[model samples]
Target: MADVFRSLNLLETLKESIEHNKLSDVKDAVEDLLISRINLAVIGDRGDEKATFINSLRGLSAGDDGAAPSQSPVAPEEMASYPDPKHSDFRLWDLPPAPSTSPFEPEGYMDRVKFARYNAVFMTFSQPPQPNTVEVFLEARSQQRQTVYFILFAAAKGTEKTLEETRKASLEVLTSQGVALPKVYLVRPSTLEKFDFPGLLEDMGRELPEIRAHALLLALPTLTSTLITQKKEAFQALVWAAASLSGGVSAIPVPFVASMVDCSVALRIISKAQLSLCLDDESVERLARQRGMEPTGLKALRTCALSVEVTKGEVKKRLAAAEKDLGTVSPKLVEMAMPRHARSASRSFTAMLQALGGAIEEMAADGGKIVAAALGEGK
Candidate 1:
C-alpha cells in the first residue's frame, strides 16, 4: 500500500537523520522509546534481607543515601518506598508482610496494595515460599503481573549443594501450582561478590523492554564486562552523532573563521556520553568507593575534565590563535587556506571523538578489573 511505503520512507529518513548526528532528531528519537515507568516492588516478611537485596539492585551499600531503609519487624501496614539512587524515575518499593489477620482475602490484599501497578514484583524469602508468599504470587500472576523469586542464602553459606537444593525446592513450589516457573535469583547479600547476581541482572534486562533495560543497565554499577560493553556501545552512537554534526559544520563557509560550526554542540555530546556511560568523575568515584578503592589511580578517569564542559574562554583563545596565524597571509593566501582549514576542523572533530572512544575503552577495562579484583575472580 502507498501508506505503508510512505511510512517506511519516513522511518528511513529518520534513521538517516539520527545516523548523521542531528541533535534534535536524535534526542526526539531517544525520548520516543522511553515511555514506560520502571517501578518494582520487593515483598516479603519483615526483615533486613529484602532491604539488602533492594540496595544491591540499586548499587547502594547499606546506609547509602536514598537506599531502601534496612529495618526489622516491619509492621503489616507499612510500605517503604525509595527512588533508585542513580535514576530517580526508577523506583523500588519495600512492601510489608502479607497481612496474616483473618478476613484477608488474597484478591482483596492484592487490590489494596495495587500490586499490579509495578513493572515487576520480587517475592523474596530466605526459606521455601510460605503459603502467604505462594498466595501472593498466584494472585499476582492472575492479575498478569511480572514476578521474580529471590532466595537469599545468607543463612546457609556452606556448600554448593545447598544452593542447588534451595533452587530446586523453590522451582518445585512454582511447578506444583501448574504455573510456569518465573525467574529466580539466588543471592547472598552478605557476600555480593559471590553467587548469581550478574546473571540475575542479565535476565532482568532480557525480560524488560529495551528502554527500561537500557536505563537499568545504566543505573547498575560496572559489575561485569558485558555491562560495560553494553554501556560503551550506547555511548558510541552518541559519539558518532557528534562527529556527524561536526562534519556538517565543516561544509559551511565564513570570512575569517576557520570553522563556522559551534564547538559547544560537540562538547555537549561528549558530556552527555560520559555521564550516560557512567564515565563521569562522580559516577566513577561512586563505583570505586563501592569496590573499596581510591578513584584516582585509573588513567581513564583523568580525561574526565576535558569531557565535562568546553568553555567559551577556551574556544575564544583557540579562535584568536587561529586568526592571528592567518593575519600575516595575503587575501589570496587566506582564500586558498579556507578549504584546508575546513578539512583541519573536521580532522580535529574526528580526533576528539577518537579520544573520547579511547577513554571509554580504558574506563571499561579499568571497571572490569576493579570488579574482578573485588570479586576475587580468577584469583
Candidate 2:
C-alpha cells in the first residue's frame, strides 16, 4: 500500500515543488499536455453525405449555414477537413468518397489518403455497404487501424425493427468478409438526440487513445448524462495532472490574506476544467436554450464559483480536524525537508480537486434537470 502511493512520482514531485516554490517545472509539464491533437477520418460512398455526417457529428444542423453541405459535391480530387467545431485538436477529415463505379480503379486511392495517419476512421453508408465500400473498409482495416462503420438511414424509412435489420445485415456482410468487426452504429441525422448517436460517441471515446479521448470528450456537446460523466472523468484526470504541477513548482509563501497556498495553480486548473466542461455562461446558456429553457447559464456559472470556495473551505476544515491528532502521527524521512505548511498545501490541493468535482456534479445535475424538463415539455 505504501509502495502504491510512492509510485506516483509526478504527484510527489509536484507537491514538493509547490510546497517549496518551483514554478518552471510545473509550467513545462502543464504545457506538454496541452498541445496534442487527435485526427479522425470520415469516409463514405458520397462526398456530400460524408460532409453532412461530419456536420452532424459536430452538433450542427444540416440546414444551418455553418453546416457541412449535404448537396454541394466534392470534386473527385479534393479532400476536405474540419476542426471539431468545439476543439482545435480534434479534427475530422472527409476522405474522398470511395470509388463507387470502380472500387479500386484509382491506382493510388489508398496510398493517397494515408489511412494510418488518422487515429480513427469512420466508414459511413446511406444504405447497405456496397462491394466497393467494403473493399475500401477492408483496406483501411488492413492497416490495423480503429475503424467505425456508421449506417445512416432516414427517419421515415421504418420502425426500430427496420433499423435493427439494417444493422444485422451490415454485421452479416462484415462477418462474411472476414474483417474483424469494428464498432458499428445505425443513425438518423434528423433525429440525432433520439437513437444511437450518443452510443456512437461513447464507443468512439472508448476506442481512442487517452489524450485523443480526452480531447474528443471535452469537445463533444453535453447532450447526454453518459457524455457528461465521461467529460467529468477526463477532467478529473487532468486535475490530478494539475495538482502534480502545483507540487513540482518551488514553494511560495501563502499570500498574507488568503488561506490557500497555491491560488494561481488552483485557479488555472479550475479555469481549464471549466472551459473543457463548457461550464462558461455562454455555453450553459446555449445548452439551456437548446433544452427549451430561459437563460439559466449564469446561475450555473455562479454554482461553479461557489463550488471552488466550498472546496477550499472543506480543505481548511479537514486540516483543522487533523490538528488535534497531529501529536499521535509519526514524522518520516520525506517530511524532513518540507516546510511546516507543506501539509496544509497538500490538503488544500486535494480540496481544490474535490471542489471541482463537486461543482461538475452539481452542474450536471442541474443541466440534466433542465434537459428532462424540456423533453417533458416537448412531449
TM-score of each: 0.68, 0.70
Residue 298 lDDT (model 2): 35
Predicted structure 2, TM vs. truth: 0.70
RMSD of each: 8.9, 6.7
**Which segments of candidate 1 are over 4 A away from where they belong?**
1-26, 32-37, 72-75, 100-104, 147-158, 190-193, 238-359, 376-379
How many residue pairs of model 1 clash at the backbone? 0
Give a tens-digit lDDT track for model 2, residues 1-379.
1432332344456555555565666555445344457777777754455655677566555554456676545575566677765556777777766666853643367667876678777777756676666777776566555544555554455688877777787777777776665445766654456677777776776767655665666666655655656666555555555544443222354243123324544454545555555556555565555455666533443444433333445434444454334443234422432345554444433444444445555655544554444346345
Write candidate 1's Cα lDDT for 1-379 as tens digits.
1222232222334345534545457445434322235777777775566677777766677767766666643456767777875465678888865766665578877776778677767777766676666777777667665535455445444467876787778778767765575545777764454577667666777666655665665555565666667666655544443443444345444322214333554344444445444555666666667767767653243443443333455444543454344433234422222234344445434443454445455545555655565555798
State the weakest 10-residue window (summed lDDT) of model 2. Answer: 328-337
Error of 1 at 128 (Å): 0.9
